[model samples]
Target: MQEWWRSAVIYQVYPRSYQDTTGNGVGDLAGITRRLDHIAALGVDCIWLSPFFASPQADMGYDISDYLSVDPLFGDMADFDALIAGAHEHGLKVIVDQVLSHTSDQHAWFKQSRSSRTNDKADWYVWADPQPDGSPPNNWPSNFGGPAWEFDPQRGQYYLQNFLAAQPDLNFHNPDVADAILETCKFWLDRGLDGFRLDTVNYYFHDQQLRSNPPSQTKQKEILTEVYGMQEHVYNKTRPENLGFLARLRALTDQYDDIMMVGEVGEEGRRSIEIMGEYTAGSARLHMAYSFAMLSDDFSAAHLRDCIEGFQTGAPDGHPYWSFSNHDVVRHVSRWGAHAVSEESMARLTCAMLMSFEGTIGIYQGEELGQTETELVYEELTDPPAIRFWPGVKGRDGCRTPMVWEKHAPNAGFSTSKPWLPVKAPQATRAVDQQGADGIMAHYKEMIAYRKSNPALSRGKTTFITLPEPLLAFTRTAEEQTLTCIFNLSADQHIVSLKTKAKVALGEAVSLEDDKLTLAGNGYAYLSHGAEVPL
Candidate 1:
């Protein structure tokens, strides 16, 4: 089989918000099956579904309770089988989210392990003795809030929880735990899964010594959205031993044909890009990996260039998957709107930039419509962190709202009844049916088609061209084609002199005259040129 993922575009489906066929106010497997055509029409090679597995709904299915079964809230086994079959029939590979780093407190394995000091699975999870004063094992803080260790009175110890207290970190230091998780992965592979979107891939292992983490040197203004960022996370996660487990997981997937895994590097800054490079450094680890580098609020040319170039320099042998939005964070259109003339223009510019990047790409649900973040109040909040932190952190529920399909239909055609997350007027106004023939959706389709048709854009090596602020330029060179991509990142128009003659292959508000290229606010140009020519 070929390495199709190297150039593939994957569409992420937040199942709970995609479509609701059950009339139960939530999206399910059958809902996804019925919506396969919608995704296929977008020309994405694969659909990466967030977790629909058996869970207590804590952390929105990330805290898996059963590795081999589906949650009743989503559907039964038959529904999943039908959804998989439907996706394949539409020429789309189906990959499900796999949360291997941790499990729900209700999982049978965690229950058994916590029941006794010496049960058969006692060491399946990371557990430690308390300090002399009954404090947590160390100073590690949970990504959500508070201490990272939860007191387990039954076991008379504290368990490591990098995220919510309900989601306990697994002990990969124990070989048995690794073997068991691998077997769980095999169960899905046997059922004909395309691959997996490994959740928190770098958190699979922790320092065995349980040493306290040192204070982060990060500037106070640059701290992340959680207390966890206050320290340099050395002992709790991203350990060196994580690579071995990734290799083993890769070995499992290699047994199946045409399978690929894309891991989520749950990190930030240059370290996030570095971890992405490390995780996907070779065929022995993840097929490709993505980081939060592009998901941040930084909208400058220097920041974007640093992210792409950082990955290239860090791991020349590794591959990357890039995205501007996902289930997490605010939508790109709203987050970067300040830098654009309009939300629609920002949407068009980001699409063009993302499609031209030299790697696999992913687009979240509703992204094609230039969807903006939902303005929600405290009463409508569902995300754990937002609920706990309140006004300090608005959380991700805004972006996880239902997909608006019909302009006038109830709940915007997402469901017959109300959705778990409200579909407000601002978001509903941008419904799929309301989009014009030449609108944002059409632009997305056009950009995706353009990327796929051009060999240089799809399968090319990237070489950045030094440019001043507000101007980003790069060349994608494939054996058959070479294209120079230039973008005006600001809301004001700019003109640049081209060094060589070129034809405009694709662009907006852009004109080529003589040797001058004029780009409007948020405009971009893809200029076709010869490899021998420099522009």
Candidate 2:
């Protein structure tokens, strides 16, 4: 039988900002457990919680010190079990983030590996000797800026870290390390986790020979501001050996019934979609894989079509998971504001488009509220990249602000005390309570409900329709019906010329007898053959 995640809408929750039941200013597993009803009300099939594992908090929980233990900041194992149980009770599947590509420098295995070259676990992590001149082995740059190799004088070698120096990449070449990570996954699978959201899925392996990556063939444009993207990033990530490790992960997930795994393929260019295709091509690998293709500033219809069509052609058998916003980047409403009619309209239109796509959907928390990016001052910045880059890059902390539950409550009811990131007025105004009755939240709930009610929208095959610029039109066809989805992905109004008579299905039932449909800016409409509209 097909897994639930194949046609599911997975909601992403950033644990630190999701809720704060302790009044300690930080979100914990208990806070998440208390808020499971809100998630269930959103009609999501699964909740993909960000990592809350034990970490030094250097790069947040992504730099995990212990995989088996929960960080004191986020509660203990009992809390985690409760969160899982609560989520299940609400009829929502639980998918936790797993950072298997790397571990915290504080991890016991890495500590032992860095202590001495003769240690038993010395080969557990990727370590290499410096050149004769004492220079780093390769020219690979870290994703967080500076060198990817950190000099460890104790071992007389440089350790590999694709991300922050504190988050050292594990040596997957070592079979023991791979087995150990799999065992950690089993620990959670046994505890009744639905699956995992594999972080940095492509950074699992590196060039064994430690080859230097050459310059990018494409012209160096300022558009790719992230320092890591300045280089070609060949040998540092996306190695061939990563495939076998993914296969191993798939085998482990297959041990549990109805379990699935979605990998985050972080790569530049079209390589992201290509990697997604390869990673999820067969039953031996990931169940689904998502890339940054939809997360970019490009909101053009052509671009969207290219991204979806590219994946369709590349991985005919592979499944794709699509998301526009997450904790790592700026909110889509603000990121693409120039092209949107309004933030609220954009949120509805984007969600409608996502629901219409032929793949799994991931909705980040606060998206339903039509939340925009919060303004963060220098002192309020906790994200390293934002602090290092300063005014130029506002960083991810703005997007990671605490979720607002009440408008007038302290810190908008996210915390009784100060939170990790401040909850600004703009974000607070769109709080969950305010929107619950008759706001964007209602629209989101309605949209999700509409999708669930329609078989074509939920589990249908997608086919792109020939539409002009600024209009993204597609038809989702199932055995019982065919639904046409049209979106004006621009600030300017678009006139959609229809070849046949149809009735709008979701919002309003308007007949397209004139052979032309007028769509407002950032407008979207779902059409069916009948005149009777569901709404």
Which candidate leads in TM-score? 1
Q: What is the C-alpha RMSD of each candidate to the true structure, in Å?
A: 1.4, 2.6
The lDDT, on a scale of 0 to 1, for candidate 1 is: 0.91
The regions of model 1 sitting more than 4 angstroms off are 222-225, 531-535
lDDT of 2 at 520: 75
Weakest lDDT window of 10 consecutive positions for candidate 2: 506-515
Candidate 2 error regions (>4 Å): 223-225, 507-513, 530-535
User: How many clashes would you count in candidate 2?
Assistant: 0
Residue-wise lDDT of candidate 1 within 1-535, one digit each (tens)?
Answer: 8988999999999999999998999999898899888889888899999999889988999999999999998889999999889998998998989999999999999999999999999999999999999999889889899998999999999999988999999999999999999999999988889999999999988888889999988875754456777788888889999999999988989889989999999888999999998998867999999999999999999999999999999879999999999999899999998999998899999999999999999999999999999989999999999999888899999999999999899999999997999999999999999888898888888889989999999999999988787999999999989999999998999888877788998899899888889899999999986511233
Residues 103-170 of candidate 2 have per-residue lDDT tens digits of 99999999898988888899999999899999999999887778899999888899998878899999
For all predicted structures, in order, the TM-scores are 0.98, 0.97
